[model samples]
Target chain A: MATKSVAKKQVETPDGLTEIRWHGRGGQGAVTAAKMVAELALGQHKYFQAFPEYGPERSGAPIVAFTRVSDEPIQVYAGIEHPQIVVVLDPSLLSIVDVTKGAPDDAIVLVNSEMSPTELRKHYGLEGFRYYTIAATRIAVETIRRPIPNTPMVGALTRITGLFPIENVVNFLREDFGKKFPPKVVEGNINAITRSYEEVQGE
Target chain B: MATTDRDILAVTGNEATAEAMCQIDPDVVCAYPITPQTEVVQLYAQMVADGRVASEFVTVESEHSAMSAVIGSAAGGARTMTATSSQGFALMWEVLFVAASYRLPVVMTTVNRALSGPINIHCDHSDTMGGRDTGWVQLYGENHQEAYDNCIQSVRIAESMDVRLPTMHMYDGYVISGAIGPLQMLTKDEVQQFIGPYRSINPMLDTKKPVTVGPFDGLHGWYFEHKVAQNRAMDRALQVIQDVADEYAELSGRQYGLLDPYRLEDAEIAIVVVGSTAGTTRMTVDKLRARGVKAGMVRVRAFRPFPHEAFAQALQHVKVVGVMDRADSFGAMGGPVFLEIRAALYDCDPRPQVLPFIYGLGGRDIFPDNIEQAFAQLEDVAKSKKRASSERRYLNLRAD
Candidate 1:
């Protein structure tokens, strides 16, 4: 609950079952992000339930997709209220939604923001939660050549939390993308994921 | 002077009626139970264990699955049944209508209970009211005797070749389901002859003539065609209700169809009611008539295809019609009964202005005194010519 922004080092707890809530507009591959993560965990032999909660939502309307991974069978049925981690694909959404409203004090926040964590707090006020900022759009554009931030943010989430090995995350992406996309697109996404993971600055 | 025939031995109404359903030997029975209705499934399981009823009882996880499995079993052309009430009934809303739309002819018994905000597990009409328009023919049983009798007849009505839409038999969850009283059961041979083996039109699982089920389709394509076909089948079911009720009554010696009236020969004021409330309302009408007040009772036994002509005739010469409902329609001009009763009177040249009184909600005990109170409320409405609330109000809301 410290007020200062600082990068976090590689640390492991006994069992930190990380849950990720993705905030994006419709048709932004946010649900695809959730599915990819679920597929990743399944390939790694870690059980997960990744699902989208939508009811007649229109395009460009804000939507949230969810993912849960744990050592035990998940019994809690309610949607993620206070997420351990939050991923915002669109930086423009920060002004409209208070994404950090119910974020736990010990939670880690990830955003596709170029704004410094200090500047972000001065305007948005981080409320002293640990957070990481990544320019996923920039990474997606430079490496993947697409506006979709799903793969790049997956990399940021993987690097920031070290929720699992980077190789495992990459391997998951390769397996999931291989069936659908061409080899070039898959390789480009893999590059974007790796680059975002390398650049994600955590607190 | 005791007859050795069927009479109530001491047992809970839920246990007795559930055992009766098991006695019918359903091919598939899937259910998810709410408060008072849980014992219905529990008794069915016990019957299954004791080898009294030989049927594959699928103890499903949710009321959703309870209905889902019934749809599958019924589509596979099995004589299937399920039981639920309250939130459980609400949860099955999606599939409940599907069973009818597919014309599976499934029979469901709503061991009626109160719906929740602050939940109560007692007898009321709210549980079954949510499903009034699932195209399923809805029937209400007054007491435990009717509960036992109707569960068997319901199967016959639902699965009959003429009436292929689903059917729901509703009885008060606690008032009937929990109460134990003098009950009579139909003999095995009698029930067996009444409900013949299932003969379905189009079964999905049969390999000899297999047809696809539950497929997604284009609106102008397969979906629209199947929906239109369902509408025609439901119209046919309206006639079947009369056909089955007549035949069953002759066989069993118990009279039931819809809208049983009590002494409305030439009354100016008629009270039209539904479910167990009709029984009490009849007593109130009797007391009112004894006091030199012109009063009569109309008991609505069926709630679908809504005995409109029959119900209207019951109110032929009545000046004022008091419609009392155990549940509210919420944000409508009248209670659920008030809407239909008023609609029935809409065409008559000299029709009674139906006044609605919503009462006995959430299984709040509606006694003989409560019935008189409802009559008084209706009198006040008739005098004032205005409703207390256009939006539904809690009938017996205790003053805290």
Candidate 2:
């Protein structure tokens, strides 16, 4: 007899889970973003899991990190083979890696790019899929005075999935940054998140 | 202060284990940086640097010196801990037995990784399995939460009166070490109160009662008796492990046991597994159960004591058993876990047909499908009442 005693939870999203795979360089915070999204989901009382695929890579080498958000305990610990959403923190990774390798046709593909999603869809011929583009790097540079797009991409992710309220994401950032950085640095990241949340476009 | 919030945080297995270390606040933490295991030390070092913990953070040059330094501190009656993996653990081979034999209650977190020849840095039980008989009580974790909890409980288990043995807790290198998951955090006060204070026995620092540690044994010395005493401590550790786990459950409301048996009540075919792969095995078992197959899993949480009686009792009803070992013992009849499981059930009146499967070596990914295939093989064996075709089986292997 199976003991099914898991306390059911109500999350903001449908389908019970939103598994995401993030593609980025070693120095870029794809792993950090994956962790942050998992934290955001946890803060909202949802179950989540995140992890990075580590290789013998130097600073600029390509990497992949994965995150899974669910209303129930996640049992899968293997690497993500088929993600419901693929978020590319590095647009340069597109040419080399198959960013949408095992994604279903209706999977959402979010990229940190200067080009619009419609143009990106036309360029990549991503038919029968949801494509999103956000100028996260530009937003980060404008607000945080750096090129790290992870924080901005978090904003875009929250906005796109509606997984958690943007305020909750910002509040998590505020607490996380407040512990490590000064108020000004925290504000810079908050602005980056809010700006990208407003500017993220999808088709 | 004391935090009663019990808020869940999304954290990597390394980060969660380190947080438990910080909360425990040992006297010394001596560790060297190594892949997979490096992040645990790095996070703990940051905690020490930021004054979150008073643990004397000793940055050692090599894994050997790291274990040596902890041995010295632990002998000096200081609560000491460290973290290492793979080759680093291989480097600390000489001192591992020394720590255990000296009856030092030191705790070490071994992020399980493959000992290298091809220089791979991934999840496997090779390193810890290599030191299986080093006399330290070994606890394996199946997820980030278990990793965190084991780190905290290792202290109390090691320091227990009846079991003054050094303890090593392990989780899969990249799978649990690098994976991020949500886990509840106990306040600093809760951990401090749970672990309490460390009481030293035969401490080197007590000049008035000066005693020798690691003294040479002559031809007529009681070295044989010392070895027997160590074995006694290991046997005593089983009870201490259960006691500590029970108390921890009362404090956190989350209980852990020597073995995690899932859907095994009336199982005809079952799999015995360890570490993070058990999570995958459970999912596969659930899927098979849905199809009217009585598939079950027993995840061995405590590997050192082997939990022979508990395991034998759990497998009483099963007709076929599959023992999954992530690390293989070359030339041996079966893997380390398989050998132990077979030995545990040796005296049963009607023993189950046990099959040994070697898998996930060098951090190879074992998906749910691979686990299902293993269960499928077990189902066939259960149906036929015949032994599996191969003496040693390898799962998820690629053929050229």
Candidate 3:
């Protein structure tokens, strides 16, 4: 029998969704960061999706990943054409790729760099959006003892978007990291998140 | 609807499937690594190494060997499983039929990928669609949650007494397999209880009832009768698939069927699709519906035992139906799915004009705009009541 009783549950979020694009080089943990943000949203009972733009994945190659978060179940699997937020994990990618290619006028653009938001805007000739900057790699090196900027960038994004509280992200990271990493490594990541959250500078 | 207490886990489709496999904890799992699909077995291997599962993890040299090993284990009266994609699936083509013909209830996850010519490793339905005739019960999943659910249900469907055929559940490579999404998971205890225990039939391992498997069929042999019996099991699978889905719904609060129809009851135009694109098509249908367009979509969840009756009944009142296929059928009128859907509607009293759409080949993107365009074309056919071109239409293809 063709059963019509099992109607697919479609929850509609009144305010739509937040779509984010992450620009990073291969091996920089762009995909991991994208997934981390989505995972954080999942903890809040928000529907989320994260995926990388698949290609010949080689180290140092420019790559992009995306995340969509909504209060409703996300049904669209298409690539994000106009992202509400764009995160640049590697500052070098800014010159190579148009990281803000499809961003709207009011989109939030976050970058991992030592430059201030104004300096980044003028240096990269980037404009028409709220630009934020943080020395994520420096923070990661100081805390996590690694140059991987993904964790710090996640911190900056959490602070910039205020999507969830900083303490909530910290607690989530503590529990998540505790399961897989040694005590020192777990504390290092927590420090990276807290440090970046404090040091991130934006308008 | 009854609901099971579930935990929401954010994971990729591969992760979800591997998690289900950990829950199923079959007697044997033989696998070879391939792009996108590599993560599933890798995770499962970790489970096996961590002593989380009691299954023997066979690290085969190749996909052919992986399928061969699973068949051997299944024939030896063990619950066996495997996973593969693209070239790996092509390598297992011969053994795929062997497992099915031998009636070994070996469950597998065929992460859909485009077959290599230019040597691409990305999502497309080509690999599995190529093996559609290999006598395996095929199920397609639209997302990670469905992929997880289907992986669990596949064990029950394939191991069912009336439908003891090898089964493969497919999800788009990289799209679902590698992408992270939300999934509500069933506990390991619930899964074990749901699928029950592995029951051996005509066991080769049983000394009291030793049976020969894969015996050569000569001109005098019952090869023809055996083929007929296999087809009969496939016919029985249509019901068994539904019954399992019904029981799964009672346990999980999520329901599935042979076909997942959306807004098709009084539609003037509809599109039939499979895999991840179904979600995109559903969103498109909703967008069109908001503007008063009678748009509908039916996602083919089970492809091998094609639901002809359900399709005919669901799409009977529609004026035009568009069938979307991600893989081409070479010189055929359209894609494999289009051919089946058009044939399914052959007996309609007031036959609706069916159009063939071939899209997303070699992992090309199929946006909502592309699906919206297809619906617009269908709406045109419905309004004019004129036969559209029989030529296969291409979505999101460059015309230069």
Candidate 3 lDDT over residue span B1-400, tens digit each: 6554467889999999999999999999999999979999999999999999999999889999999999999999999999999999999999999999999999999999999899988888999999999999999999999999999999999999999999999999988998999888888999999999899898789998878988888999999899999999999999999999999998889999999999998899999999999999998998899999999999999999888898899998989999999998999999999999899999999998899999998899888889999999998888884688889989999989
Range of the 10 consecutive residues with the lowest summed lDDT in candidate 2 chain A: A1-10
* Candidate 2 per-residue C-alpha lDDT over B52-169 given as tens digits, one digit per residue, 9 for 90 to 100: 9988998889999999999999999899999999999999999999999999999999999998889889989999999999999999998989998999999999999999999999
- Candidate 1 or 3, higher DockQ? 3
Top-lDDT candidate index: 3
Worst 10 residues of 1 chain A by lDDT: A5-14
Summing lDDT over every window of 10 consecutive residues in candidate 1 chain B, give the lowest-scoring window.
B1-10
For every candidate in turn, the CA RMSD to the true structure comes to 20.0, 5.4, 6.1
**What TM-score fits each model?**
0.63, 0.92, 0.95
B86-113, model 1: which lDDT tens digit per residue?
8899899898878887888888888887
How many pairs of residues collide in model 1?
1
lDDT of 1 by residue, A1-203 (tens): 55555333233211546677888888678878876776566555554556565433587888887786766433232246567788888777777887765566677878887765666666675566776788888888888787878889999888877767899877766876788889889899999999989988765
Better of 1 and 3 by lDDT: 3
DockQ of every candidate structure: 0.01, 0.66, 0.70
Ten-residue segment with the worst summed lDDT in candidate 3 chain B? Answer: B1-10
After aligning candidate 2 to the native by TM-score, how far in Å is the CA of B320 from where it should be? 1.8
lDDT of 3 at A130: 83
